[model samples]
Target: MKNRVDFIDWLKAVGMFLIVLGHYFGEPFDQFTQPIYPKQLGVAFFVFVMGWGLASETRPQWQVVYNRLFPMYFWGVVIAIFISLIFMLTKGHPAITNYLPFIGGINVLGNFFPSNPTTWYIGTYLHIILLWALVMRKVNVTLPLILLVLFCEIAIRSIFIEFERLFTGYMLVSNWITVFMLGMYMHQQKDNHNNLKALLIMVLWALLLFTWASLLNPLNITQTFPFRLPVEHSTLISSLVVSVAISTVYLSNTLLAVKFFSGIPANPVVRFFSRNTIFIFIGHMPLYDVAEPIALIFVESGWGKRAIIVFIMYVGLAVVSELLHKAVNIDKLKKHLWLRLN
Candidate 1:
């Protein structure tokens, strides 16, 4: 199946590009730029891709779904462990709160609930995956799922707020459902309705969404006190953005200005990307920090060098992640690397 959709691989390429870009802090356009918030902003794109991927797996055999997910997540644990171990030994264990925020992220309970800060994504991801398998499974995904999650959380906010709680889970639920369903809807349409006119509607919304997201961030609408609003900041806007991006990719089946971005997965580039996508994802964070000091050196000497550094960091991540997955023979890796409880 890796030979199936090159378009996704191209999207993976785009997502991977953003991963490195996110780490960088682009300067204020002095012939070179490094932006600190790109990653946070760029994250919705990747997360949306994840939802789209899930949506594609409509009623996939249980065995197949389990097989695909387990190895990737298990390796994430291994990488995170090595990361923590290295930091602990070298940095003298850092602060407890700083080093470990989510759970150990090893076994089911830890991974399901999450603790270590870096692995927060694990819990959040698992949260959605569980929903995908259960509550949202084989269901016709429409706007209601997103609205239900958001409004339910909104209703509970006053009570939860006193516990110093917030509605983060709702954000994930709302965003993934809308985006993933859109992706699934696209996959369904791909069989019979790949049309340029369809792509046009998607393009219009895509541009509109980008503008909305950019504007809200500038306004910091989500940053105010009481920290809770009737409608959350950027949640609705991001949902629209993610949905349209999914639509654009699915409809036109084209990547903008990038040949490598076209086709089914079998193309060596897509296969390489789809196969080791998780590895590159889990490994990039630690590796990206290492790149920053190096980027600084180039930034100080020549602004043009900053882009080069970001490029190097991205390529280096792909290479290293590919090598590591190869080393593990991930295809034959253990089932349930995480200890699960009944």
Candidate 2:
């Protein structure tokens, strides 16, 4: 069995790239890829990949939790504090209320949601991992079982729309349960040589549904509002759309295992992007605070100028990521924290 799957790495790199570009597309870049970047799709692909990775670990151990889960929380807090400082400096008072969502108060009342929109992903990811830690200790992590859990949550939400919509909107453990499980299933079948037929079926099914949904309503392709944020959720249509998108990426990589993508998992560039996905994800939003203002100056400067801005943003961020990787060394710090805290 292969230790590293290049296609998975490729998919991760592509997904993170889309995510950053999606967040970056506000002023100057919005026109370049309006209603096409599929931000939710990138996030969904990431969650699915996470689930795939978690599939092998039936018993959620402390070391894995400390290593894998702590970074998001660590960065989430760091970002939250950073934002708080900004708020104080700019607004004359550090508004702790604004940062409430970071502590699981995003959409508790069914209407009040993430004021700091970027915080939802990391916060919800933490909740999902914590739940898995507690529950997977007693039960097995499998596709059917996860599907049942998803169905039950869906049913409950249907019954108590207001309550579920309010609470589950932010604490999204149950909302995306199905997609996460599907990711685990993907991991389970990683070595399937017969995946070509299944991949074709998934592609066809995805296309058919997308076309059908688009013909009836094109908005379906781009409309994902999980937790009242402009992010993807675990709705039936969304689940299918994201699942197919991820599968397509994986299958495409597998089928076309040559040229640039060949041995890509080991390639330094691909490895950097794939491994630093969380860093890119967390850092990009803040970087946008700076990049957006600069890009806006060149908003009307034509495509060539806009293209340069995009390239600079990508390269600058990549450099920062590399620097951050070398400077603080997040993994080592997390391990250190775990040692001290434990």
Candidate 3:
């Protein structure tokens, strides 16, 4: 087997692009495209990849957490402080609290700095990593464990609802943990594929896609679907179902990609996006805000306009992210910090 998987990089690039493109959509465009391409599916891809990549990790738990999270936390603080200063100068009131590390999610600064709300994934991702390192990694991949995790996730959400203290990051953890575990399961079972199993998995995946679409109904195509749950419970169940469904679809696609495309040489562009995903993911939103007005001046509101704007924002972010990636050298910084901590 090859030491590296090129298809995984391609998938990450695709996921990052989908997320950025999703954020660019507004109003009619979002409404039009959401049913066909839910942005949350991009997140599912990342979480799944995370699980697969880390399945065989042998590093100490704290070391793994530090290696994964510290660079993000470092850059997050820097960006948060910079944005806060900008707010001070422009809006004349900065959210001082945003300067603290992980005060909000380490990725987007916090709710106060809403420029990149998509960074909510940072907190959720961090929690998932912590959980996996501390607990999930120790367990054997089995049906019972998967089902138990799912049950615990649902139970946690139900309790959160009961208490009315719904932490978004924790809730998202509950939402995506199963997908993460499924990733681990996939890694474990990568060599066990057969025609019958593949066919069954595909069939189940199709059913999930249908169920997810019915639940989301982004187009409002049909308000009344059979087997709909009661109103109060519907929202919770719907979110979980949609997450699982979308994630499973991506999982199936991942299997196909690995099977067919893993040997292909990596595209430079896709590899760039994959490697710098976190940077671009965090930076794209703020850059989009700056690019949108200028882009709108050149085109009227429509699908064409949205595409143009997204393209401009994507290119601009790529340039900025490339520069930052070269200048900062996160790996070096992480090493320096690790030494100091030790």
Residue 107 local lDDT, model 1: 27
Q: What is the TM-score of each candidate against the true structure?
A: 0.63, 0.70, 0.74
Index of the highest-TM-score prediction? 3
How much lDDT does candidate 2 score? 0.55
Worst 10 residues of 1 by lDDT: 28-37
After the best TM-score superposition of candidate 3, give how far the Cα of residue 100 lies from its true spot, in angstroms. Answer: 7.0
Q: Give lDDT tens digits, candidate 1, residues 5-40.
A: 555555666656655564453333111101112333
Per-residue accuracy of model 2 over 35-57 as CA lDDT, tens digit each: 22345456656667676676667
Model 1: residues with Cα > 4 Å off, grouped in runs: 26-42, 46-51, 55-65, 94-118, 142-175, 191-271, 296-309, 334-342
Q: Residue 68's C-alpha lDDT in candidate 1?
A: 49
Q: For each candidate, what is the lDDT?
A: 0.47, 0.55, 0.62
Please state every model's RMSD to the true fold in angstroms.
Answer: 7.5, 6.7, 5.7
Relative to the unseen true structure, what is the C-alpha lDDT of residue 43 in candidate 1, on a scale of 0 to 100?
A: 40
lDDT of model 1 at residue 183? 53
Clashes of each: 21, 1, 0
lDDT of 1 at 214: 62
Regions of model 3 farther than 4 Å from truth: 26-37, 95-101, 104-115, 158-171, 188-266
Model 3 quality (TM-score): 0.74
